[model samples]
Target: MNTQHEFKFLQYPRKNFVRNNWSNLNGRWRFLFDDEEVYTHPSQISQWPLEIEVPFAPECPASGIGDTGFHNRCWYQRTFQYSKNSKRVLLHFGAVDYQAKVWLNSHFLGSHEGGHTPFCFDITDILSESGEQILSVCADDDPLDLTKPRGKQDWQKDPHSIWYPRTTGIWQTVWFEEVSEIHIAKIRLAPQLERWEVGCEVFVEGPCFNGLQLKIKLSCEGKVLANDTYEVVHKEVHRRIALSDPGIDDYRNELLWSPEKPTLIQVHLELWKGETLLDSVYSYTALRSVAFSGDRFLLNGRPYYLRMVLDQGYWPETFLTPPNSEALRHDIELVKAAGFNGVRKHQKIEDPDFFYWADHLGLVVWEEMPSAYRFTHDSVERIVKEWAEVIDRDLGHPSIILWVPFNESWGVPDLAEKESHQHCVQALYHLTKTFDPTRPCIGNDGWESTATDLLGIHDYDDQPERLIKKYGSNHNIADILTRYRPGGRVLTVEGYPHGGQPIMITEFGGIAFVDRKGSDTWGYSAVQSSRELRNKYEKLMEAIHRIEIFCGFCYTQFTDTFQEANGLFRADRTPKFSLNSMARATRGAGYSRGELTSTPQPPPLPAPDTEI
Candidate 1:
């Protein structure tokens, strides 16, 4: 990763040009800790401790302060000096787990709330003329609060199964880059290969970019199609241009980006004042699409099954953030070793490096919105605001295919019946689609299914015959599952039943093999031995390993959390189940001598659409 050229990392394959070139701002930074004053304003920040790497969360091993305590909030301070010729200095944060406040050289920049979304601030005016300028940030996260999106975080001080320690502070890269004040802030690029069209919207921030000539181009296989210089006098510009012949079929060798291909097209942007180039920036883009037909999801317009694993994105050594880019690569390698086509990133939006690796490794992501606490008028507003930001900020990535907002109704229980809550969920889904129509949104995962694109639910039983009986002809959801469940679901079934149109176990196979002989864990049930759990799990795996009706299934998880032991890997990134065994069971390569009901059992099956 270090030897890769700078342009190679910052580019995204849009139509002919790349999106904003601000993503590659990564490097070393200073460190400090304060309650409030130090972060609210950089000037009030007093002397502090040593320097640390930016982007790497303090909890991560690569970060200088690894394995730190969370009782107190953390403060990050950094100083940077840029040349006067620099057009603009923008500070970008890939993510912070909770709430964060930013200040530039004593000037208040901005404050944001939300743990898994990215935020940025324009600091062109706050930089010094010649020397170092201090950058301070304060982060506060209370995992036990249950008011925010703290997914599977241990309620206790120490971590255990099913729940990991919260990444309480800055967990992603933080850096600043210089751009023209009125330069391109963000670009939403959509490639329609079927229609030979490329739609784009440019978000502007300054004067020079308002009315200048913005030249756009589309290219592939080292060949350019269209290049036009348009005028944009406002802060935002929307444009859609038709490519001569969407090289989709005409091009000899296609750049169909996938984990295997991972081909990228270079995109260059230039702001020209007549013949003079006012600003020149480099980026890249990929040509891909994700959609859904009936209950089956489609990628590149073709049906694709999601052979995935539950990606909790946690490491005992790093908590939420990986130690470095290499650590990010290591996680991807682990997923590939498991023989999964993708990862269902449960509740957390990981660092950019994680997404980068997913893009390179060709991993599809079921990007779920982090689950939050109970929702009221105020809390719902906060969650919605964060959702919008996350959607917009991450639209450039090709890895994300589905957006899941509500998981088992953790924060919201009665949204399907409430007009306002239902409206919020529907509105966010619509907004997400309007921003990036490339992918289909799951709307909400499990339980309450309303006017959503897909009907997703969870169950624990493995009786495929039972699923065919209940959903096949039944007409109501009331008889399927009970509300008493922590995460409600349809009638329990283990196999991937075919009668249930686009059915997915969604949640099951959490066969934990961890033994906590002397430790107390916060679980609804008492601790069980790894041998006992794995035995039960192998039965479940044997049931679904070859029954290929369901779209896909995500096991309880990839790693152990606080008290939830249904993870393939232990809490410390060590595999509990042999990787070789996992590879065989996951890729439809294993079979058990279980009964395959040729005749119907007394019990029933499941259904989609109406219910039953």
Candidate 2:
């Protein structure tokens, strides 16, 4: 095996999977890069840095490196020692963007493609006791390649608009474990509200698990609600447990999960042959219902407008990782503070930590499948594998409500073939529904809106009246907007970038002032005064309120990024607007109350990065 890695500190289910002396391998490591070049052995590295963190890439600040140029290849190398009693050593990488090839101690294990999924290797067959083990990886990602599902990743050195710079190499946690032959590899939780049961499939690590015993326990808070024991005798194992009363009603009355409240219950599982326990894992879930009845979304059977923002989960400092859990918590909290019920996690399947926070914070999430740069038949397989991992891993969380597959055909090279593209979306839609029918599946966020469960619109105008002029009436524009079936909910996610409320001003109030004070930029820099900003925002809100035609409306942003200055808060998480006033405005109250006289800001802030 390569070596033993005991990251006990970062272990989840902290009570059971405690890692008391875990070390963070997130610093400098030697590196090299070349897409066409192949160096299977770490000893054969050429023209590269010596080390980088296993999870954070060289470009991100957290990785201890600056920025990697676009359209480049990257390689990383590291060494560690293996200890005794480590019968089976395994290497685990939380996530690696683009493509990666893994090697341990001069032995070739495997390679994985896709930037948003986690992969592992079993090093039991090849380990040297107390000897240095070598690790090598190579990654290739082109942020500008629209053929892939590159969400908002820009190819340029600097980012602008919605597109941000690409993250390469390892941008997640990496470690190793010493596990036994008979252990649980993964747990699949499928909650079926209709059957009042939760279906499960446990994947065992080694071969021949037929004699192994599987134990499961479900609970609310710390109190156990249901328990079951079974035997796994097949390559693929499945189990179902029906609850007497599947809902939780401890004074709270069957805890319902919504943006207003998020409740999660704990679940524990173990594997054993008889008296010997193999592996045990603790997880959590929330009892909730999300469905599409008739033409609207019903959360607990109530109509809800999914007010959401386009959250890419990228940061200027950490690349992908938040500065800390508190940072993650802060983002979700800020979204809620800005009057958004949910976020459309654009083009990235987030880490569990992000999801955990989202669930607890009561913010809804629209999870999307990250796409590759190029499209091939095998792309579907890769998408399926990564997406399956994402779905199963986050299934227990209650905040996720919708799943998006193809985004305006980013990774869909066959988009020219309407029938074929339609098939892809349809296939994914069916797959989504099959997994969790309790939730609605959005086939494509802004593809046609007709093919999906709800209609998503991206329109922009400098004037609110223009929106009414274009989509407000039964004219030619409305004919185009309403091309699809009539039942789907029509929503304007992005439209003409107006200054804010016209007759009044509402919508997103960014930290343009700070950007002007610090960076000088904006989503659209046409205003000249804070009063104009306030007016513009109020006018947009006024327009939204006046029409009442949108399911819900979301302004451009919540905070500042690298260069884009359209945030209500600085990039450092400090509030830009007077917190009290921003909150009051976000509370759905009318801003400006009536016609306001204010000069518009002329030299608008520059657009940061434009991501797809």
Candidate 3:
């Protein structure tokens, strides 16, 4: 992170589950475009000509260098005081686009390939004892490369229909941390609802972890409820602490996390060597369970309907990167204020800070992977690697209940006809479950689902009666919809069957209302009056509510962005219609509420006629 205070970009520089002894490196940095990728250590050459803020890519206007054109390679250089100590120092990058190589004081550290996952390097050996050190980063990003995951980042010279400007290079916070020789490298908390215990997986890094014991204390409102100590011999250790332990009889009252009341259990972790404290860190977790029974999506053992919106996570100035931490929290608040229990993050793997805010604000999230435009061995390998990294980085957050590996078959287009494509989708579904069996994994959202726990589909039909006719029936699943849908596509592929999974209209109700007359804004169907918009919204939601099989519905968007003017709010976050009306229309009475139903009802009407 650059130490230039005046040029600091990130308001919340610290990463989630943070500790003290950390410094923010998000300020003015010397930047230069390297199209040919010639320079290994660009700092050694002449001074960089351009100055851009760290974490905001050059393509973004907030970066102070709004170069939206194609530049395959770029270098960032900054200097900060870092005195070497007995402990290890780690340099962390929240995320960098495509390929990133780091150098410390002219010494090469290493390179990371994924654009969406956080990566770090131990720079203890290369640090100076007392003086300043030069830190440099080189990123090579190709927007046109279909082999890598690019979610909503337009590859063309200009922002196209749906896709926006590309975000290249560092687009998230960067920081430095000081840790003990044997410190906690990573920790994962999985709440075992049935067992009434929280499973803790701790990964330590050092030459030796012998004689080390991990002491954990779970508390709420300054009162400790459960405490445990486990001896650790291996680098990776797994331990479980029962919430029903002694003195924890009221655990359910203060421990369970939900959208209405998000309660976080403070965790005080300590690493000791025979009574000597080796290291200590602070963390937090929430107890929650997400399951699917027949057509109902269960949250903590009961049916909970998910009222969600499609959040593209874009801003006028920052594009994919938010301008500040306040913006992240504001979005969550807006979702809740506008009567939404959750958000399907669309195709982007968002910053961990967003997830942190969601967890704190009690907003459920469907964590979806960014899509690759084409399907190939390279695309498959890259998507799998990046998605695995993303899962590993964010699986600890309780707000994230579902993992969506694909969206509308953006990459695997021939899933219905090609056998290999079906196999690929199935492979990804099983792969996600293998990593995290706790969360339901959606193989491909919307259509052509090979293997998925959640059956999500997209429909933008303007008429409410048509939607009611399409889904409200009691016949075979294949006969539910016989004609083409709003976008001229089948509801489900030919061979794939609804295998009793929880279903949702993950994308729908994109009612377009343009505020400006001359603007080129549009939606699925344009409405001229606010009253019409409200009536349409209510009618559509009423149709959705009548279908008991649907566990949830996600409207097209939260706000208007670029050419997509179908948001409930404008691009600047101003309400397009009355907030109360939108809340009433999209959220009809108890259907939109997150209230849990103890007894799951039977599925909705089975078959539908083709006409409205």
Candidate 4:
């Protein structure tokens, strides 16, 4: 394939289960709004009045129909040529907002809910005998419904305080892949840094066969580290593969993964049944560990201070969907250029491409679930279900260091008083830990925390002196948690007192610079010029660095998202101030203990044994 086509296919919905051959069904598609809910099936829609760009919501300018008005329901139809062959076809949707029902050739395929996670269907049987196949989708998203996870989407007519435009339907990639009758369905790689081993779990689908085997290969820099094969007795197989330990710190550090040095261990897997290859996939992972030591966050068994920026993953043209794959990489580059070692993906499960780049470019990510406003049975169920899928989809990425299930008591609004709300928070926290115990899980990020591994405070006070005074020492922190409440919300729930977990200001410093004239924008604090912004930012950094108790800090945001113009860069990604100035302010003289340094380049590795 040519470079453009290759790039298109490389935008695979899932990074872990990637295949070389696949079709990109993105470009233009027939579209229409179904506000009246008249069409229940694709056959009922008589005419297609509009065309929309796939993966971009109708509310976004890139979708061609940039109507930001309230339209709860919409329809999409597209046809692709597919010749029936020996292989089975699987259709995948990266994500659809709220709820989605799909049909192929007017045949009812299936339905999926939860806006942030991916869902797929086996479309082999539903394909038309002819070369062309018709695929239709009906997305029903209630704009006013607060019971579903909406992320930063506003339900109102226009963009509001913090929420931007709504992403209605097909906000992520849509494509299909051809696979054999039996293939690898899923794979999960868990890094056990302490033991110098990696736990591999593979799930296979199709008919049960006696001679099915899975071949696994691990390599780094063209040197083979491990090559093993296992007989598949059942659908799921788990094994721990040990790596040769380089006892010296210098040699071992090269194998470990950090934001400064992202050394990925390339993985190759092939499913075989009696010498016939059923499936083949290529993936990568790294060795890393995230933990807490008293008031410090430990990475690779050492105290590593986190300087993270809040990224909403929004663009001027595309609301939630990135315009292109390169945009995702560019965003990470921008974050690193600003001197932030990590990013808190605030209130949204970002596209897999974002995580892919983060893993490759060596940037830490805090994956957070979007919030549902109302706390109800349905809301709880929806958040829990989607959150699991979120974890399941992106669990293998080495860049992710933390899992944030709730933010600032969103969804569970009465968490401070209601016992049920507190239970819900605890439940979600435990659920996240149960799903993936490798990383630390934050129950409620901002305030009113319960059953949390970390205590995250979201104090947007722009005053640096007040911040220092609030979190200067252990006594001040304890006092603020018990007596003084930031944002009029208690730091922890009534029963769940501060448990001495590492504390960090997960949200702060939302200083808005009005780059666009008369744009009706706002932030926690506004500045008139770049100099003023720089002065205020530098002071805040200085204050944060002086705070001996804080383990880390996440600045308000990375880009100006809609009306909430509290970003280092504008919506177009142009920096508000000079990049060097921003980086200097972000890094600030140095940490009290020591200065942060880039990962040293690894020396040449010794030769490894040839694979059998």
Write candidate 1's Cα lDDT for 1-612 as tens digits. Answer: 232333443332121223233434456766765534335455555666756666666655666766545534677776665645556666777677688888777777888888877778878778777767777787777645676766766566676645566576777767555566556666676666566566777766566433477787656555775677778766666887776653445351265565445555445566665665555554455667777676677776667777678877766566677665667667777776766667888878776667666765667788887876677765677677787877776676677777887776666666645666666666767876776666777666665654355656665444445444444334343344332232543322222122333556577655545565664443322226655544555555656554444566676667766466567777767777666566656665432222111111111100101110
- Model 3, 325-366: lDDT tens per residue? 779888888887777889999878888879878887788999
What is each predicted model's overall lDDT from 0 to 1?
Answer: 0.62, 0.61, 0.81, 0.87
* Model 4 worst lDDT run, 10 consecutive residues: 603-612
- On the 0 to 100 scale, the lDDT of residue 270 in model 2 is 72
Encode model 2's per-residue lDDT on 496-576: one tens digit a residue: 111121110113333255425545465654565656656666565555545444555555566666666666666776765
Lowest lDDT 10-residue stretch of candidate 3: 603-612
Q: Rank the candidates by lDDT, best first.
A: 4, 3, 1, 2
Q: Order of all candidates by TM-score, from best down to worst?
A: 4, 3, 2, 1
What TM-score fits each model? Answer: 0.79, 0.81, 0.92, 0.96
Query: Highest lDDT: which candidate?
Result: 4
Residue 74 error for model 4, in Å? 0.6
Model 3 pairs in collision? 1-25, 2-25, 473-605, 473-606, 473-607, 474-606, 474-607, 475-607
Taking all chains together, the TM-score of candidate 1 against the true structure is 0.79
Clash statistics: count for each candidate: 44, 73, 8, 0
Most TM-score-accurate candidate: 4
Q: How do the residues 1-612 of candidate 4 rate in per-residue lDDT, one tens digit apiece?
A: 466655544666666567866887898999999999999999988999999999899998999999999988999999999999999999989899979999999999999999988899999988988989999999999999999988888878888899888889999889999889999999999999999999999999999988899999988877888999999988777999999999999999988889888888888888888868888887788899999889999999999999999999999999899988789888988898788999999988999989888888788999999999999999999999999999999999999999998898899999999999999989998998999989899999989988788899888898899887777774666686887678999998888889889888889999988855778887998999989988898899889988888899999989999889989999999998887778887887752222233423332221211123
Tell how far residue 394 is off in model 1, in angstroms: 1.2
Error of 3 at 501 (Å): 1.9
Residue 349 in model 4: lDDT? 90
